[model samples]
Target: MSLFTRLATSYFFYFAILGLISPYLSVFLDGKGFTSVELGEIFAILTATKIVAPSLWAILADKTGQKLLIIRLGALLALLSFIVLFWLNSYWPISFCLALFSLFWTAILPQLEVFTLTSVRHSSKIYARIRLWGSLGFIVLAVVAGQVMEYYAPGNLLNSEANLFTNAFVWMGTVILLCLLISTMVIKPQRIVNKPQQQALAITGKLLDLRFIIFFMAGVLLQISFGPYYGFFALFLRDLAYPGVAVGLLISLGVVAEILIFIFASSFFKAFTLKAILIVSLAATALRWFIVALYAESIWLLALTQLIHAASFALFHSASMIFISEHFTRCQQSRGQAVYLGGVYGVGGAIGAYIAGVLWLDGLGASTTFLTASVSAFIAALLMLFWPKTIKKPSQ
Candidate 1:
């Protein structure tokens, strides 16, 4: 396959599986008789592995100059580990399977980011164009899963919960297998030129810059605020009387906006400072969550809220990618991406998922959980207001 095709397809399948899990997995777990607290613990297990796995794999990939090899190995092992989910029907066993699966899965994306940026010579716009395919794949599977669940797992159907979730699990696994197949087809990544290693102190000193710390801390807050949505949005909709297909469409609406944002992300970057874009996205995220908290049962309000995902995720992510690309050196690129993943998606995700579980129980409820998320996003925006208007690019 051509380099462009390989890069785009990698994003497509990687997130296709993510689409299966992120929006539907809670419902699947609920169907299997797990409580909200158990779901939170299980999801935390899945995300917490991300904290260490990416960095460990990145160190090996950087030292060996074999990023594609690492990607391939991660994909293969992740697929193998995930296969155990089919046989493990209980809490600890399934959690163990998910933890193993996540360990391998976390190894793929950071290295892939370095490879894609290197392939395209670090044009952030081109990376967005390629990455948008992942959004497209996500939309497709989310809608399909919704429709399948509606047909087989409708509230009125006999044993619909089991039927609905079983099929969803099957499809989620199928997407992972597709990811593995595509991993085999992608063009191999070129080796990065390794540089003399920096001392631990020097590397630590560089990352300790005030701007860098504030930027990533804000990102952590943003992810933390997404806890309820990521962990329970589908279930929230279902409880509000929406069918499975409608729930899928609701989820897809956000990605649809995300896709549009990515198509024009390069233009936005060229036109605005990263800080400005980040502020707008963060502020909008706060608004989005507030609206969801207040009006989740209102289709119109939810649809309007979903459109803000373009700002919340797509624009915010584009700005952060540019920040990482400019701030870190080529040799440190994989690890920098690893830090972003580990910090924002890893640690942040774990905190959010677990907390959302706690807040999702009786008395507090989903709306209150989302209200807390909105407060968190607003705090993140307040932090972003202090970001430096300009950053000095580090020399590798």
Candidate 2:
């Protein structure tokens, strides 16, 4: 198969695991008798590992010219770490296992993103086409997992909680193993192209640029605002008396919208600048969160708000990737992507999740937490307005 085909396959499998895990893991952890605070701490730990692991691993891969090797190793470690989770029940042991899996799991995707962009350097318009497959995979796995949980385990009642979660862990571990094997098989052997000495220095210097700082800051804020939704949306629904299947369908609705946006993103980019796309996404996110905060009781309104996930997440992400691909040169690409993921999604998400935990514990509840997120997104939208219209091209 061709290189893009291989990357697409890897994306599909990688995101399938994400689809299965993201919507249900918090619910699973909650089933293990973890309180909101405990679950938040665990999720924060998992995300915090990303702040360090991806960059550290990327540096090693860049220096050793072994990006594929590192990805395979990370995937293998992620698979093994889940096994430890199966046998342990206490907070500390479970936290340690989650940390280990996250360390490896976090390292794989950014590197693969770098690989895909490098391979399709000039044809970047098709990036979403490849990535949308991941979204599709996510939709399928999430819906199926929800159905399975409902059929087998029914409610979140504690009587059969162990059985439900063990089954989830087994499924997650199996997918990771399969993804690693596929990743290993399809990765072409290629020499790591290093940046020229002077260029490397210049790239480091660019980190201090005001525009770059502002852009990164905005990215961080965006993820931070998403913290409550990622860490506790399911629990919130359950607390509101929504059934498991309804929660899953609500989550699936968002991804379906995301998939539609991704399918048409290239055209949208053609008509609008990356900054404009991002601005719209942030605005939509702001509105979406407010609706969730106030109208979560209404199923129709809740589902309507989820449809905005297209503008809020899919558009923003695609625009960000395009920006990174355009702004960074070949050698700096991997680390650039890592910084985006680490600084934005990793550190930012950890902070958001932690704060949401505190709010939930303090009885501020989901509505208030989502209101805070909406405010943050509004601020993020205003911040994006000040971004420079053009980014400096990486030095040759």
Candidate 3:
């Protein structure tokens, strides 16, 4: 197959596994008899690994000029390490497995994103088109996995025997990650033109510039607002008495909206400034959280909230990717992507997941937790709105 096809396929499988993990992992842990605090801590541990893993591999890939090799190794090792989950039944052991699993798993994506940007020569439209495949993969697997879990799990999913269905999710995720490795292997490495290396001090200075700092700070808050949904949306729906199929559809609905936005992301980039997209996405995210918090029992309102995901995730993610590609120098591309992933998705996500867990366990409940998420998203929007413009003109 062609390089573009391989790249798209790699995304497809990689996100397929993520689709399983993001929406279902909490349900799996809950079924495994984990207390809410323990669940929060474990998810925090999983996300925290991303803090070091992506940047470490990114630095290695940059210095060694082995981007594809690093991608392959990460995918392979993550799959191998994740296999230990099938037998381990306790919190500490599973937490250990998750830490290793996420360390390598997180290493793959940031480097792959850098590689993709390099290959496409910063074509925003093409990148979005390729990324939409990941959304498709996510939709298919999320619906199917939900059905699979429902089939294998006994009633209420709390029984000792019922929890075994969660193992199916682990196995499915392992196979998908392995498939991603194979896709990476088949991808012909592009000839990356190495830019002249800048001094470490200069690189650090640019990375710590005012604009860069504010942009990442906004990104961190945005991801933080996603904590409750990512860590416990499935459980939330289940508690509200929604069937597994409906829960899967609710989760898939957001990704479905993501797919639509990605198909036209280039047009958005052309019509609006990056700041506009970020503001709109953050604002919509805030609104979405409030809607979810207040009207979760109203399936129609929840579906409407899912549609806002088009703005919250797809547009936001596309804007951020382009922003990173344009702002950072060629030599700093991998590290720039790593910083975004590690800071926003890693540190931000860890804090969000853990706090959401605590809030759900100790506070009024899920609704109150989601209300807090809304406030966080609104603050992120304000940050983006006031950020100093560093680019003179739009790149699209």
Candidate 4:
């Protein structure tokens, strides 16, 4: 198979598991008798581990020119760590297992991204088309898992049978392990052609460029703002008395928009500058959060708001990938992606999730939490306005 085909397949399986795990993991933890505070702590731990794991793994891949090796190792480790969940039950043990799994889990995606970018040189627009496969996988698995959970919820009474929750957790872990296995087999190893020999400090110096730093800061804040949305969107729906099908549809609506963007992103990029897209995406995020904050109770309004995810996430992500491809040297690419993930999704998300958790328990409700997210996105837009113009243009 072609490189893009392979990469797309790999991403499909990887994100399919993520689709199942991400949206429902909090629900599962809640089922396990975890308080809001405890669930937040667990999510924080998972994100916090990304702060270190990706960068460290990227450094090793850079030095050895063994990108595929690192990915294989990460996938294997993730599979093993997830299996350990079947045997552990209590909070500390569960947290320990999650953190361990995340250590390896965090390493896989950034490295895969570096590989994809390298393989698809000069046709980066195609990246989104490939990435849309992941989104498709996410939508499918999330809907199926939502149905499964709903089916089981009626049969089991809460606060009575801990084993049912444990069974669900094990099932999630098993699905993840199977996906990792498939991803491992399908992703062919690529030789790293532009391996870095300089000390890590030299590469770190590149990030000091004011433009890159500003963009990174904006990206971090964007993700941080998403903390509450990701952590509590379903729970919020449940709180609003929405049924399982409605919750699944709400989640699927966002991804459907994302998929549409991915399908046409190459064309969109051809017509717009990366900075223009970035600004628009940030603005959409700001608006989306406000809608969620004020009008989430209206399903029609909420569904319309979900369409903005095309701009908020898909566009922003595509722009960032293009920016990295244009601005950074090939040798620096993996580390650049790793730093982006670690700083933005890792550090920023941890802070946002923790703060959101606090607000959630404090009775601030989803409206207030979402309003805070909107404020964060508005600030990110202001920051993006001053980003270096050089990074916005496609490479000559």
Best by lDDT: 3
Models 1 onward score TM values of 0.94, 0.92, 0.96, 0.94
Pairwise lDDT winner, candidates 1 and 2? 1
* Winner by TM-score between candidate 4 and candidate 2: 4
Worst 10 residues of 3 by lDDT: 193-202
lDDT of 1 by residue, 1-396 (tens): 688887888888888888888988887787777999998899888989988888899888777778888888888888888777666678999898889989998888898888888888888778889999889888988898888777767455765355556655765776665565665455765754555463121245547877789998899999999988888888888888898899999899999999999998888877778888999999999999999998887899999999999999999987888888888877778778888899889988999999999999922498889999999999999999998876542111
* lDDT for residue 283 in candidate 4, whole number 0-100: 85
TM-score of model 1 vs. true structure: 0.94
Better of 1 and 3 by TM-score: 3
Q: Residue 279 deviation, candidate 1, in Å?
A: 1.0
Residue 243's lDDT within candidate 2 is: 70
Across 1-396, the per-residue lDDT of candidate 4 in tens digits comes to 777778887788778778777778877777677888887888888889989888999888778778887888888888888888777768999889899988998888998888887777646567777899889888887787777666566345655654574577567767766776676677777654653455353566678888789898898889878988778777777777777777777788889999999888878777888877888899899999999899988999999888898899988988888887776777777788888888888999898888788777733577788898999999999998997775345632
Candidate lDDT values, in order: 0.83, 0.78, 0.86, 0.80
Ranking 3 against 4 by TM-score, winner: 3
Q: Judged by lDDT against the true structure, how good is candidate 2?
A: 0.78
RMSD of each: 2.5, 2.8, 1.8, 2.1
lDDT tens readout by residue for model 2, 1-396: 877677777787788777766777777777677888988898898889889887888777666656677777877888888777667778999888888988988878887787766666635466777888788778877777766656555454466554675567456657656775576577786654563452243356556766677778888888888988888887788778777688778888999999888788778877777778888999899999999999999999999998999998899988788777666666676777788888899998899889888777733587889999998888999999998876432211
Weakest lDDT window of 10 consecutive positions for candidate 2: 193-202
